[model samples]
Target: MNELRSWPGLEGDAIELRLDNIELFGSMMEIYFRHAARLVYNSDEGVLTLERKSFVNGLTEKRQCRLPRLRSLHVFLDTSSIELFVNDGEETFTARFFPHLDDRTILFGTHGHLHMDIEKWEL
Candidate 1:
């Protein structure tokens, strides 16, 4: 059962989620996306970024997601887009970009010491 309620994630150090059953989403049939994501924290700038991999016309998305709540960052990645949600959807960012087939990895980058637990999921 690949139900969302049954989706698996982490609670410490880091968090990861992969939507293996995209088929459940009726409108996601033609969508080319993934579930796993990267989590990066820049304590210096108080930003949380969803890193993009090397690909054609690639782009990365960042938000002024402050600290204290920095430890709970969530990033959802698809082959061509990214979605960010934090504090249970309090702060959200919807990012779209172009990606190549080889662009399958998400980068977790930061400038200062900050702990993050990012959950990755795709629809």
Candidate 2:
């Protein structure tokens, strides 16, 4: 198993990830944006979830896709929105978000070791 945690947090409007072979038992990945939102990928369940915690009700959205086979992922952030793509464009998910947290810190975690490459961009 392997995990990565952001200590100083990430600052940017766009994020990208490249991962390979995610289909392992108990395998999962998550990205936390301070108290604003979170994106979770559950390889075992073939699910991708986005939760807006800054909302009054903590709104949650989910997408079911074969993530284990996906080798790439991307996230684009706007003033109040998020866009996600998987497998270099095989699938996409988009949503609007309102974050309660003012901090722009970010965190990432994985249940198993992944061949991952990450990048952040300022928009």
Candidate 3:
């Protein structure tokens, strides 16, 4: 069995994580944005989504899943692609997108508090 390793983070804190193999466990709400493309994953409703809000052609992608209370997720972002993994690779979402170079923002919000361990990295 794989041991669950976690780093400490408080609720409503935008913590910086420095690993290609990033881990997110516990109940969470993540809004990850790679430039123009944004990915939103919510555990309460069991949904993962991606959308582009820019001058380029508008597009959206979504994957629905009923995962565990303490779920695992991995995300990869490149110049033209974004990959998302959920629940120890049980569910995955991947797409190619043109990113807006000027702004890249990621937001995380929970039902009441951010009851999850998350670390962000600049890739």
Reference-based lDDT, each prediction: 0.39, 0.64, 0.51
Better of 1 and 2 by TM-score: 2
- In the range 26-46, model 2's lDDT, one tens digit per residue, is 578777765466777777777
Candidate 3 ranges with C-alpha deviation above 4 Å: 1-28, 53-56, 68-70, 119-123
**Residue-wise lDDT of candidate 3 within 54-82, one digit each (tens)?**
34555454445555443555667665666
Off by over 4 Å in 1: 1-40, 49-68, 111-123
Superposition-based RMSD of candidate 1 using all C-alpha atoms, in angstroms: 13.0
RMSD each, Å: 13.0, 3.6, 8.5
Candidate 1, 32-117: lDDT as tens digits: 23333344444445554554344544444334455433423344555555665555566776665554555454332222222323
Per-candidate TM equals 0.44, 0.70, 0.57
Model 2 stretches astray by more than 4 angstroms: 1-4, 7-9, 13-26, 53-56
| Residue pairs with backbone atoms closer than 3 Å in model 1 (clashes) | none
lDDT of 1 at 86: 59
Compared with the true structure, model 2 gives a TM-score of 0.70
Using TM-score, give the best candidate's number.
Answer: 2
